[model samples]
Target: MFEGVDLEVPAGGLLVAHGPAGCGRTSLLLALAGRMRLSGGAIRVGGYVLPAAGRRVRATVAVARAAPAVALEGRLRVKEVMAERRLTGAGVTERRIREAFETVGIAPRGSDLVEDLGPLQALLLATALALAERPGALVVDDVDEGLPPDAHGSVWQALDRVRNSGPGPTVLAGCVRTPPPASGLVALSLPRRSLDRLPAETAAAREDTAT
Candidate 1:
């Protein structure tokens, strides 16, 4: 719940939504990504209006939530996920998958099962999978959750590379506190309130980024 919330996010910039637990950070991210609907106001991304009919907004925006389950079948190998994504027309190539893994500093080992990877490795793999799509925008929630503090910097570096890559993408990260340093980063604070009063300009700005 965010009331009369207004924000300005520049193109190719990183926006960190910071607040305490249950303060609607994730909700705001989901709403902006079109995974959730707001009771009032509007959301647009990269000029594509959200909650629109037959819109391919999901393809343009990649979202990784906090403690997101990898949904890896026990029988599937690490490489199989990439294969499945390609078979399903996700356009994920072996080279792209390899590059994504390398981007996160993970070595490609096709023999490894998803269940065997440690927590940090699993998180990196998930991010690689998302990056393989080369989406125009990324919405990550609680990036630091469930990880040792030392690993946070590496993850932040990876995300920064994603944000600074060619043409790049607008990134909106949700968290219970401040995010690590990154170039061109902005912070937005959300306080609990009725969602109906959210600012139209801010919603439109979000839509522009999504587009």
Candidate 2:
């Protein structure tokens, strides 16, 4: 839905993809994380290139809470989710989970269900889960949705911490609007283009087929 968008993010930097809905913000993040294939153009994440080396890229990239692709099921408990990640071969452990929780500054009870978390807490949990994997890059979508404007800073700050964490993973986060500037935080705006008028299902089908 967008065209001619070029990006260059430093390792461990936070790149905010900001735009209105249907402007390809989510698509761009997915593509960068190697979770979605691009119809055109090239992407290079560290030493890996798009599409051709997608498998290698995916091995070191983690996508979290990026709707439809990665999301917490309401019925699952916090500990269950962590266990599932471990089952999937992520290096998830109680200690790593604790580290992630500390970085995100939240500690939901292990017995608590995903739905019980508030908006910010849910986001924080997703972030922690992704970070616990220790991926080379992390992608998060809708970073500022379902919360008050005042609370936006918390999400940004948590992401900043992720960026600053030692040998941090490159972070790609989406938002409806750009937040204030911060060190190593870069903002890229995606304007709605003609292709954005395509129906959602059609876009999804295109992504599915390409990938």
Q: Whose TM-score is greatest here?
A: 2
TM-score of 1: 0.81
Report lDDT (CA) for all predictions.
0.68, 0.77
lDDT of 1 by residue, 9-80 (tens): 666788888887767777777766666666666666766766672146666777654433223454678878
Off by over 4 Å in 1: 66-76, 191-201, 204-211
In the order shown, what is each candidate's alpha-carbon RMSD? 3.3, 6.0
* Top-lDDT structure, candidate number: 2
TM-score of each: 0.81, 0.89
Candidate 2: RMSD over Cα atoms? 6.0
